[model samples]
Target: MNTSRGYLVIGGLVLAEAALLFVPVAILGAAINWPESLDFAPSQALPLIDGQLGQVRLGYGIYLVYSLAWVLIGPAIAWLALGRDKQVGPLFVVAVGLICAWALARAIGIIRWLTASTFLAETYAAATPEMRQTIDLIQSSVNAWGGAIGEILGVSLFTVGWLVVVSLIILRNGGLPRILGWSGLFVAPILASPVIELFGMEASIFISTLSIHLWLFAAGFMMVGMALFGKEA
Candidate 1:
């Protein structure tokens, strides 16, 4: 329960969480894109999609299971590393709240993506020329409004909430350098904003997401290193 050992445990858990992200990303990405490939040629990819969906669902479920581990274990680890005198109660409460909000936002985003993708594929395939024109109008309306709502509320809430909560933890605990935490906070608002207006024009989902993942990985490492190296201070 010394600082060094505490850090190592938390750091290891963080890395494990990062590593687990790849499972669902790989599986779900394949599942989402699999149907598109079916149009190119007669192939076995359709079945693969079905199979991947099962895997993705299972992987996502597992991910959710472990989501609480870090937050719960982290404070305890941090307490031991930096010493029991540190006031980590607020940090713990914030972390838990952020995790819950993130989980809810993620659920909303996934539902939106799945619903939109399925509707587009089914509706587009079945429509006659006249129906297609009508449906196109509907689609435009839906996308314009629905997409805005989903992006703004679902995605933004999760991303920004995560950035703020994680940054606060680091800043409060003095676990990692303050600059990285500040940088994360700065990036959060950009990631949360719509990618159309001038302020949000330069935003790239890929870059933003990748950067967040990298920060999590680094934070995890820092936690583990502190646990394994630091004395009770």
Candidate 2:
């Protein structure tokens, strides 16, 4: 495809992904105080799930869609990059690879909510104290393992890697506004802030979330403009 057409597609996808973030955020945030709820112990979390299983499932189901869409954006960005140069650079390859890993890890993290957590919630609701203890152990393990893959690996690391690489490419290529590129660079470290949790420090994920949302929103519009009017300084 031509560059304008490519930008159109990529821009639209970026904007859609940015907007789609709100669905799960709003739904799960209301249903279970999520994201924060993600950290709740089984005794606390299971009850919320038991009380609002439908909302929890619905929120996560939409989240699954959002996460899977992340995969598509990778290839779209790769396509745009390749169209510009007619060859893939190491950065492009790395960006696409990280995006794929991000999508998969996020999906794995979300699947627990839809499938395993539902069962655990139901079992916990009726379980005796001993059984509840076992359930707690199982749920905690799931949260730790899945959280590591999804939150730390996918959201924090892989996504940040993609942003940094892509931003550098944009800065060099002038495919989008240079300001957008700088903004991406500015946001990349903040996006990776959640990774600090791995070191036993509390991550202000809210700040990261706000930074990324603003960056994506800005980039999305810039891309659409580039599509409509061609590249600009």
Candidate 3:
């Protein structure tokens, strides 16, 4: 029973990842765009409340909280997949660590927005002109440090490092399909995205966001399917 339950626990994590991809899908269903501009710089913090969340807590707050969920848990699926086969290696361990960093920094960005930015939004409409200065300063600092640097670097490590490493191992070492192996490699922009972003290609941010989430959905389901089939095998 203990053995059976262990697999079940890992499987649930993957399933959770797959489900979170639909958070955006559901957004589209409701005629909302993906929260593209929500990554507001500090100067643009006021819009977080008025712009994205649309002057309501329930609107944007729920989305950020949902993001924090998968960002925090999605990386663990990789480790659980490796452990399921009892094939733990130093390289894969390193990959998992990068994923953890990716998840953590992204979550912190969201948390900062939820806490500090939302506070700004809630007070913006009511604050005196003199009070706006203090609010803007705090928002600017947090937005720059928290969102711009932290999330960007975390994603850079994830896209350039872990995705490549995991894909290579899956293709050459794991006994998976050659096409899926090849497909995994296509997910990251190899020589572009992360590297080019350093020189200033902001579009890469959107690309990475879409690509990474899709990768999570794909990777998660692959592990869950493997785990289930392996159980019967």
Best by TM-score, which number?
A: 2
Number of backbone clashes in candidate 3: 0
In candidate 2, how many Å is residue 201 off? Answer: 0.7
User: 185-215, model 2: which lDDT tens digit per residue?
Assistant: 8899999998989889998877887888888
Say what the RMSD of model 3 is: 4.6
TM-score of candidate 2 against the unseen true structure? 0.92
User: How many clashes in each structure?
Assistant: 10, 0, 0
Residue 158 in model 1: lDDT: 52
Report the candidate with higher lDDT, 1 versus 2.
2
| Model 1 RMSD vs true structure | 6.1
Ranking by TM-score: 2, 3, 1
Worst 10 residues of 3 by lDDT: 28-37
- Show pairs that collide, candidate 3: none
- Reference-based lDDT, each prediction: 0.54, 0.84, 0.57
Predicted candidate 1 versus true structure: per-residue lDDT over 1-233, tens digit per residue = 65466567667876787777666566555565522432332123323433455554565455455444445543443343233456657655665565555555455444533455345445556567787666556645554454344445544665466567656665666556566578778777767654453354534555555665687687676666555666322
Can you give the lDDT of residue 115 in candidate 1?
53
